[model samples]
Target: MPLLTINLNPAVDTVCRVKSFNTHHVNRAYEVVKTAGGKGNNVARIARSAGEEVYSLCFLGGASGAWIAKQLTESGIYPVSVEVGEDTRTCIAVVDERDNSVTELLEPGPVISQEQQNRLLDKLLDLLRSKTFDCITLSGSLPKGLTNEWLDQLFAELCSHDIPFIVDTSDSRVLDLLHHKPTVIKPNVQELESWMGTAIREENDMIQAGYDLCRKGAKAAVVSRGEKGLLAIRKECIYKVSVPKVNPVSTVGAGDALVAGLALGFINQLPWPEILRKSAGFGTAATLSYTTGRIDSGSLPSLVNQVTIKKIQPV
Candidate 1:
């Protein structure tokens, strides 16, 4: 079955590569690539690369939005776009090859009016009624004019249908959605701490916080800890996933790739171990590759094998 992805705020990401980026000075870039991006859009791309059928629903407006639609279509993703009044935003990622570090400048995105929000929601409902999906993913940030309360209502509607939903978003938004009880939430360590309003100083602290979120409403919480790996807390068990050492090209969209992996595993009903393996492997593959949200297919099998998944027995 195809996975349904919702990206309320989509963008065109420009990735520029520079050997040594000097601040306050003119720098030359050897390579530049641009693609359709947003957290949900990235998930769609990565999931498709992993051989999953995906359908993307997003809001598009003005010239940039039109361009993003074209990019999505070119990427072999079926785009179901809703028209809006404002221009879609653009984001820039400067990859410093010297250090393999990525500096990002993100736009706030278009302000979604109430009517536009309703239209998008209605479109989503129609899609849900017309098609059968393995799962649904809601990602990226909420554009202006839409509050967390609005997101709660939308998620409640999705929950009413009993479809599993995965969410990856900003820290502030994560707290509000916990009440709605999404099937899964992927937040980084710092983001998780912010959502919980506390500092997570160690591995155990992170695990407990993830579990706390699970008890509140989320069925599971996946806390991303960059190169250190992943810590996942579910009702049944907790997972610790780590990848083999490798020099990262750009970390830009690796988290999104991880989300895609989780979606794939959830849709396939894979065991938690297999799920974390895929999640870590896909993330590592993306890091090994130059493109954002894309994994080297050849590297996945071996990379996945390199992923170490340790189950922490619940007391």
Candidate 2:
């Protein structure tokens, strides 16, 4: 199955190690490493590593965006890109071993012109018309210039043709996209809490929220909780999956990994519980690796055994 990833707001991720972080203070960095990163870009990386054919569709503008395209090309991912007017964005994540928390600086992406947006969407639609994609994943946050109507617009195309889509996003936009009824949707605890517009203090609330989203039009809903693991609702059954203890270096891209795994599960037609295991497996595996969205596939096997499955009912 062909997997297509669309990154609307891409970036060059710069990582550095530091003893400590301080506000309004200059600090020396231990080392600097830059890589192609954006929520969608990282998801493509995960899908590629898992032995899937992926096409990375993104917009490149200025130097950083050019570097992103080059990185994708070198990594063996097919890049279908268009040049924009403004420069792409960059984010810096500083790892503080002393405090065990990373400090992040995020730059909002440059605004894209109307012509640029139309050109990109034209290509996407043209491709969809010509080829059969096993799955289309819309990952990451859309930049400011991208309108809220973007997801709905594509949803119309997919709904017209019955193409399955897996979406991982947050906030009001996510709710807005829910009306399109994507084939799969993944959200972490915090995102789910925000979506519910209420506190998710216990598992019952979490279960209800997942089911509620399914009722809201998601074909299947997967909710990820660090350590506590993943929850999913499909065909009127709720699967509660838990993972064994893990010492996480960071949790930044774990949810993305889960999205990739769930996408694989959907493509493979695995049973719901197996899908939960793999999703939890990949997510926990992501925590074992640091340096930004890089996952060690070797760790997945051991972690897979650590994943326990349970059938849950909401009260």
What TM-score would every model get versus the actual structure? Answer: 0.96, 0.93
Instruction: Give the C-alpha miss distance for residue 99 in model 2, angstroms.
Output: 4.3
lDDT of 1 at 62: 94
- In terms of TM-score, which candidate is strongest? 1
RMSD of each: 1.4, 1.9
Model 1 score (lDDT): 0.85
Q: Candidate 1, after superposition: displacement of residue 114 in Å? A: 0.2
Q: Which regions of candidate 2 are displaced past 4 Å?
A: none
Candidate 1 lDDT, 174-270, residue by residue in tens: 6656777888888898787777788888898888888888877898898889899998899888888888888888888899888898889888989
**In model 2, what is the error at residue 282, expressed in angstroms?**
1.0
Q: List pairs with backbone clashes in candidate 1.
A: none
Tens digits of lDDT, candidate 2, 38-86: 8888878888888888788898789998899988877777778879878
C-alpha lDDT values of all predictions = 0.85, 0.79
